[model samples]
Target: MLKLLNQLLGLFCCFLMTACSSVPKLESNAIAPIVKLPNNHEELGVMSAYSDPWEGFNRRMYYFNAKADEYVILPVVAGYQKITPDVVERSVHNFFSNLDEISTFINSLLQLKLFVAGETLARFTLNSTLGLAGLFDVATQIGLAEQNEDFGQTLGYWGVDAGPYLVLPLLGPSSLRDATALAFDNLVFQQAINELGLDTDEELLISLIDGVDARASLPFRYYASGSAFEYEHLKLLYKKYREIQVAR
Candidate 1:
């Protein structure tokens, strides 16, 4: 139950940050700070550079995750979309995003990011009260931007190696260090929910709702990259994204 909940929790948080952002223009100018890579960059087998010591198991998990997405997650999200109005959906997104700041705040302190920690705390406080328990994100308009921190980033900041690449079934790309961090965070979250005197079924239902809300908000479709080797392409991207995030 915790494993499934964790997967949905990650999904909900992932879309919360990006859903309000504008889409990037496909065209790029020469003076752009970031270089635009062609979609077909993987045609050159650039994914070969990614080292996956546990490729055998990771591949199997990736396959399992893909099947779960198609047969289970997508159908539920479709029904959720049919029932939920846009405004209500956005409110759910905002509420979860605000709750996520709790995790970010703790991780920010763990990494000793004083400024970020303060900002996260301030965002949580302001949004929780003034924003109507996080159903609205008035803080963003006032400039307390979200600082997307997690224990994985915290561990990375402390010089912990990623250990090994992993593709958890339904959880997607993660490293050994990140996986451990995720488990720790989930345990804390579960304990907190238990302290509220909720039964196991109620907790699981909350997790399901969170996952469905998040999955409904997502814009991406599984294996929609059109790459025959989509798995490797995503694996490489996940690795590089983590490296850059840790560097920040």
Candidate 2:
């Protein structure tokens, strides 16, 4: 009887521990205070004011994207609601690899790294050809690992300090130096776009469609989180991750 009682007690304790572990903790909605600009108060003030419209635009865009993401993820969650973390992690890794290849290709062309550019071009072409136009993973098979360098990293490479944090409309988080770098990058991209001429509209349209499709692909992962707060937490995590990448 004592042995049976002891077994019962152990089972009860295990139940209590499992229940405790399943309880969700309440999280506070506190964000770190943004850093300020030095010796550029007036300029920052103007930029801040200008940024207001963009913030609204970005908020709307974010909302739309969130809604679209929810729609895309619904079917996935319905079928794979209990998918393992390792599987989800692999999907994230694959997504980043695809993005990195695109970034590397653009950067190599702009930076005039002929060898790197050639490699990127070859990788991109092969991926598009065999990977079903970059919707698959052909680059990984050929040993061409993805590489990513944003405008912020480009600026950092040139010894630019990341000035005060500035949240721009539609574009999201950025620093002063990064904003300048973005403008320069956009200018270069525009030159390339212009060089392609009127006949390239179909290609441009296809590229834009591909971008939208890619953005829509991750909605299910966000939806599985169960709340807006959880989604925002994930976003902040991504922001911090990107900032670390820039700093490096």
Worst 10-residue lDDT window for candidate 2 reads: 1-10
Candidate 1 structure lDDT: 0.75
Clashes of 2: 2
Q: Which stretches of candidate 2 lie over 4 Å from their true place?
A: 1-138, 161-204, 220-224, 231-235
lDDT of 1 by residue, 173-232 (tens): 888998889986776566655655888899898778877876676655666655556566
List pairs with backbone clashes in candidate 2: 54-169, 128-133
lDDT, each prediction: 0.75, 0.48
* Model 1 TM-score relative to the real fold: 0.78
lDDT of 2 by residue, 1-248 (tens): 11111223333333333211122333687553476435655444322322223445445655665565457534444444345364554454344345445555666655555676677777767765776545566776779755555566666655667664444433334556666777655554455445446467765763443344333333323234344343233333334444565555
Q: Give residue 170's error in model 2 in angstroms.
A: 5.8
> lDDT of model 1 at residue 94?
88
